[model samples]
Target: MRPLKSLVAASVLLSGCNGMPVAFTQDPVYDQAFVVHSGGPLPYMLMGTAVQWNEEYAVTVKHIPYVPGSVYQGQGDIQFFRHKANGVPLWRGYTPGEAVTAVGYNSLYMSVKGSGHALPAMVRLDAKEGNVLYGTHDGPVAKGMSGGPVFAADGKVVGITVAFLSSSELAALKRPDLASQSRVSIFLPYAEINREWGRYLAQAQPVTAAPTHLASR
Candidate 1:
């Protein structure tokens, strides 16, 4: 079994005055994800990534840090207006060994020249539990990637990244063989996200096109 303290939740937050300007992707499928931030002084700093679940609702990992009494107070509150999301994607379950892309707003990556806020991470699904999905990717899991969406092969969002087990954590857990390997990202399955935010999610109705107006012919 893994050590209880193995998981590290991404908590690096950046505000506009202290970090890069907010960025976004042109692809609508990946654009559904957005950065979270505080409203005051550092209004543009990225707090974390969140996926648009509907016209009025978005889903993010529960571990993201938030300022007290603000719109992003914490898990207790369901309102998030610090930053805006571009679009919404469909959801589905994941299968082992399935190829997926995790889209997140990495703090360090965004600050670098030309890097967009929404990063697409290619990872292979490894396991699933009651509340989380486990996956392995080639590179390091950077801070601020938390709350990003894990998209399945069909472009559907399957999970929301929450944490990752670092190589050191593997050593602590007595898995020396895997200690030298890359980090294992942890995500909250889409189903669980729905359950966690059911009250608010249920309130957002699917958007419908406005009726076309035609002059009487």
Candidate 2:
């Protein structure tokens, strides 16, 4: 997720935020959740977006503040437990030039209390590096949309919004042709996300040490 320029007070409420563009709209499905970081008692900062996978679990990108398999205390008393990173088989069913939706909340585009802005996008490419897959979309992804989901045409989640390629990143990747584009967003395909989920789960597991000394009877 893109970092905030400055941290606001925990008490600062979201006010006077801009609305979504005319081309974009709101959807209840992706409005399942919005993640935040505790600024303090008075104010908290909006981090990114998440989608409810089920009543008990939700899916989001790995960059948010909350850890996988942890409790996500939402606005008020509403709470949801972050889904654990799993070895669930990777999903690679998306096709190029397919219609998709990128949904998430941005401080710049606040619509409702608990919902995210939805942008119509097209699948530009889906590239595989090693065992990980990254999907590229021609969506105008903003700062707060980082952890949002990219929904396929049939309303199935295909990828998690990660970052948009910067000019330098494109250069490094040897993609000079994309330089003219205003913005091209990148997403972690479910496969790459699965890979990271497992990594995060492993990291979060506590280390169990062998007994330093045996108990003497």
- What lDDT does the true structure give each of the candidates? 0.50, 0.49
Candidate 1 local accuracy as lDDT? 0.50
The digit string of per-residue lDDT tens for model 2 on 128-208 reads 223344566665555666656777756677776656654544554556555665556666666555555455456658567
State model 2's lDDT.
0.49
TM-score for every candidate vs. truth? 0.57, 0.56
lDDT of 1 by residue, 1-217 (tens): 5324223421223212112323454675776666765435545543677777666556565444342222332232123333334556889866656666667766654621111112233222222322232434322234676667777768898776665554555455565444555545556565555655554434445456565663332
Model 1 residue 169 CA deviation (Å) reads 1.6
Off by over 4 Å in 1: 1-7, 10-25, 39-46, 67-87, 108-140, 171-181, 199-217
